[model samples]
Target: MTRKLTPKEAAQRYLREREPDVARATLYNHRSLLKQWWQWCESQDIEYVNDIDGFDLAYFRLDRQMEVGEVTLYNQMTVLRVFTRWLQSRGLVANGLADGMVVAQPDDASRNTKIDSITAQQILSYLEKYEYPSLRHVVFAFLWHTGMRLGALRAIDLKDFHPKEHYVELHHRPETGTPLKNKEYSEREVNLALWCCSILDDYIEGRRHDVTDNYDRTPLFTTEQGRVSHSNVRDHINQITRPCDYTRECPHDREITNCEATTRLHAARCPSSIAPHDLRRSSVTYLLDEGHRKELVADRVDLSVRTMEEHYDKRSEAEKRKLRRDEFGMDG
Candidate 1:
């Protein structure tokens, strides 16, 4: 007889089966979102994964929407749908139930688009003019140029810097504490433009706080207490991306004095502020725009080709072909 899997068992199996194929961050998200669904199932007494109905999925989505922002809810729901389909494939859920679930996109979804290359450059120019040698300057410059993930950047230590070579080596050291999203697979050396290196060197000499991480590892980026936390990285990006911080103008027209985002804790609430991942996406798009080969870029950025094309690449068909030809010295 075929065994009926409980909701929790199905989620664990799904994540474990996908571990080899997906990034650790993506896998973690899959685990977190599906666990939420499984928890709901437990509370509702929907013991078996096979019994998850369209109504149940919809209800669970409602519960999630209440818990997160529209963009985040949409993302989590998207993941949940994939999990639901996986359960169906195992004969644990209703057929086509995942396809049957409809999660409406919020009207404000467009507001979440990643910063474009030009905008990123413009931000750099602004930072260079006013915030040179500051953490904002170094972080934005690195994120906009290097297409590496935030986790990889966060995991860097003072020892990883090669000033003469102008590169940073990313390593996977989960045993010592810094865990890259792709783990050992993400280990690589990323070259930095001289100007970028200059700013980073300046930050190291003048701005970086003298501190270490929980593992007693000296971090390239630090707080007074120690290595900057992940939330610190997020907040730092948010702090730098704020329109008021860079542009010195409030497009939102909110009273700057009264703006909650003016405070460090609320920095991410600013509509114009971007997440660190946006910078990574912008960097990938920028490299593609500059006629870099996708494969080469993928290798340098430690991303899969499919991930580069499907998520990071934003070029039009003609733009892509032109870049390809340009790289080969062939004119179309």
Candidate 2:
């Protein structure tokens, strides 16, 4: 008799089935949600993956809702519902089991999709003055100014820099390492502003540790052993943006002697600290606000016009109309 497949086994099969049609990033995200469910079931002593029902799924949904905000919960549930439907397709779960996992229908409300983008000027002014010559300062500057994805930044190499031209070449190298989100199509040379280039020059000459990752690729941003992982980059961005760093006052009012983020290596737990991707969104918006055409901004950011408007461009309707008026020669 064929052995019963575990949820872990099922998830892998589902991913393999979907990998051909979906983007690598999308596949990774789907696998992540399913992996969480598998781990949660294991924690609950669920020995048989095929045994979970809609009621169990509902409880899982509640647990997630309590742990995260509405936006996060909604995204997680949407992925969970997809996994449930996949299970149903395989005849491993009852029909319509995915319905129980649905918590709220996603709408066009701004809050439901993304948070407000923090402007480049706001973040850069703080990072430039307070955290200068630091990795956080460098990372923040690159993310905010380039409008590049975290993964693309993570993939940068030491040789990719052309200091004379104030630009760096981005390559998609999935076979060896450092895969760009859009693969080969994402490869291009991005020019930096004069000041930004100077900052990167100082960082390379002083701070960045010279090392090669396991793939034998020499990364521009390296820690002691090799290239810094994705989590490290995210942690650096999170810690530097803590309210205490910029304001000189701890918003949480915790004692300096007792706080977790007081040290250089630790990230702040401050609720307001935004992630690396938020910086990308902010870059797109800031450029648009400066009267840069939407198409130009989209091309510079390596995103399609529709994707930028639907996702990256965070301008309000009034703000958008104001931007268009300059081209139309209309009164403000």
What is the C-alpha local distance difference test score of each model? 0.81, 0.76
TM-scores of the models, in the given order? 0.70, 0.81
Q: Show model 2 residue runs off by greater than 4 Å.
A: 1-3, 62-70, 105-119, 238-245, 248-273, 324-332
lDDT per residue for candidate 1 within 32-130, as digits (tens), equals 788778889999999787777888888888777655545666788889888878887877766888898877785564354478766787788988898
Expressed as tens digits, the lDDT of each residue in 179-293 for candidate 2 is: 8888888998998999989989999999888888999989987889898777687777666666566666666667756776556545424444556776678778788888888
Give candidate 1 regions above 4 Å deviation. Answer: 1-69, 73-109, 252-263, 321-332
Worst 10-residue lDDT window for candidate 1 reads 106-115
Candidate No. with top TM-score: 2
